[model samples]
Target: MSIRAIIADDESLMRSGLRLLLGAADDIEIIAEAAHGAEAIDLARELGPDLILMDIRMPVMNGLEATRTLMAQASHPEVLILTAFGTDEFVYQALRSGAAGYILKDTPPDELIHAVRAAANGTRTLSPSAVESLLGRGTTSATGLAGGGDGGAGPLGAGNPHTPDPLEPLTAREREIAEAVAQGMTNAQVARSLFVSTATVKTHLARIFYKLDVSTRVQLALLVNERR
Candidate 1:
């Protein structure tokens, strides 16, 4: 099935550019566009698209606020934040808001499309620069941001001496999947490497996320990096 998506951005040119780029993908269909977060939320309710390509820093409601609102619902489209800002604050906030993925506008066209598709399929996506920002800051930097700090009690609680080893619960297969994901492999990539179906890989990933208590792929990668 083709993935239905909405492009939410304040700039007309940016939305147009995104439409042009995403339109080229055979499996992705652009259903509508929104100028701000509020409109995006309304359209999401009305259209029920599979994915929402959101932008931060809008006029009335910013993307982060919109993301938090949409995700709060029992059922909502996956939100993939596509923005120019890659600052640590924006990146952290977007992830915390339950964005399915975060990527800078400068991301390559191919990678951006992949991110949208992956997010639509319930996979976490993060641009290389975003991943770099998380890694550069180290896992502890997210302690306060992720509501950690009580000796490793949050999504990014790795590296805390008092925290039980997060990786302890993973079965060998789960560990392999986690490592592959941390290495930036998509679900499809991990599936191929493990000689399993994509659905199987996704199932493992879900379990991995629960066992590790991490929400975003960036957090999982950070924990894996800290381990290594």
Candidate 2:
């Protein structure tokens, strides 16, 4: 089945360009377009597209707010943030808002299509610059983005050995899976690398999420990065 998608952007030109580019993909379908976040949300409710290509800045509501609202729904389309901003703050906020993926507007068309597909498949995709921002190479530390309260010690309590490690509950295999996921490997890629089936990888991921008390792959990646 083709991946049904909606393009949400204030700029008509940008939306048209995206529609043209994504429409060319054999497996992707542009079902609708929204001028702002509010329209996007309403269309999502009505259309139930598989994914949404969202812009960060909009008139009525920004993409971050829209993403948060949509993700809070019991059933909602996957949100993939497409913006010109690759700053640490934007990347952190986008991930924190439950975006399935973040890519710069300048990204190659091929990679953008791949990101949309990966996101629809429940993979956490990020542009290389976004990954760098998440890795503490940017102005905002990874620990902060990971919801770390005390100084640099994240939710996993990295700096305090006295505090029990959050990842301790994971088994050897589970830890391996978590590590691969933190490296941004998709389920299929992780399965291929570990000589396991995609189903097995998914099973391990569920356990990893439960063991680590994380709901999203971005959270899992932050915890694993903090450990290193």
Candidate 3:
């Protein structure tokens, strides 16, 4: 099936260019485009695309806030953050905001397309330029974003214990998977690194999500990275 997508940015030219490039992909379809974050949310609710290309610094609302809110609501789409700044802080914040992946705005067409496909498939990837910023970091260098977005409506907060230990519930194997994911490894890479099947990796991730009380991969990464 074709991967349905939405492009959310303030720049008309950026949106136009992305529309042209993504439109060329035979298996991809651009169902909607938004000029700012708030519109992105409304469009996401109406269209329910499989993926969203979110840009930071838009008027009315910013991508970070939009991503946080979208993942909090029902029918939330996977968010792939595209931003001008690839600093460590931005990467860490985006992941914590429940973005499925982070990529630089100026990334090459091929890699951008690949990132979109990966996000649709529940995988995380970084723009090559953004990779160096996070290379040696074992955990988040700053505070994590607001809670929820992973499971349900502010789900992590409602019943979570005061001073809750996010990783306390995970098994040794599940911890390994969470660490791999936090380090920005895709499922295929994690499987190869562990000498396991891709299916095994997904199985472990599901358990990790349940145990960690996160609804998405991005939130799980945030939890693991928070340990750092």
Identify the leading candidate in terms of lDDT: 2
Instruction: Tell me the TM-score of each prediction against the true structure.
Output: 0.68, 0.74, 0.76
Better of 1 and 3 by TM-score: 3
Please report, in order, the local distance difference test score of every candidate based on alpha carbons: 0.80, 0.80, 0.78
List residue ranges in candidate 2 displaced over 4 A: 136-176, 185-200, 207-213
Q: Give the clash count for each candidate.
A: 0, 0, 2
Report the C-alpha lDDT of model 1 over 1-228, residue by residue, as the tens digit. Answer: 899999999999999999999999999999999999999999999999999999999999999999989977877999999999988778877876778788899989998998899889766667767756765555423322221111122233345576566689999999998877766566777889899999999898889978987765656765665654
User: Where's the lowest-lDDT run of ten residues in candidate 3?
Assistant: 146-155
Question: How large is the C-alpha RMSD of every model relative to the true structure?
Answer: 7.2, 6.3, 7.6
Q: Candidate 1 — worst ten consecutive residues by lDDT sum?
A: 144-153
Q: For model 2, give the 10-residue run with minimal summed lDDT.
A: 145-154
Pairs of residues at least 3 apart in sequence or in different chains that clash in candidate 1: none
The whole-model C-alpha lDDT of candidate 2 against the native structure comes to: 0.80
Between candidates 2 and 3, which one is better according to lDDT?
2
Clashes of 2: 0
Instruction: State how far residue 174 of model 1 sits from its true place (Å).
Output: 12
Name model 1 segments beyond 4 Å from true: 140-228
Arrange candidates by lDDT, descending. Answer: 2, 1, 3
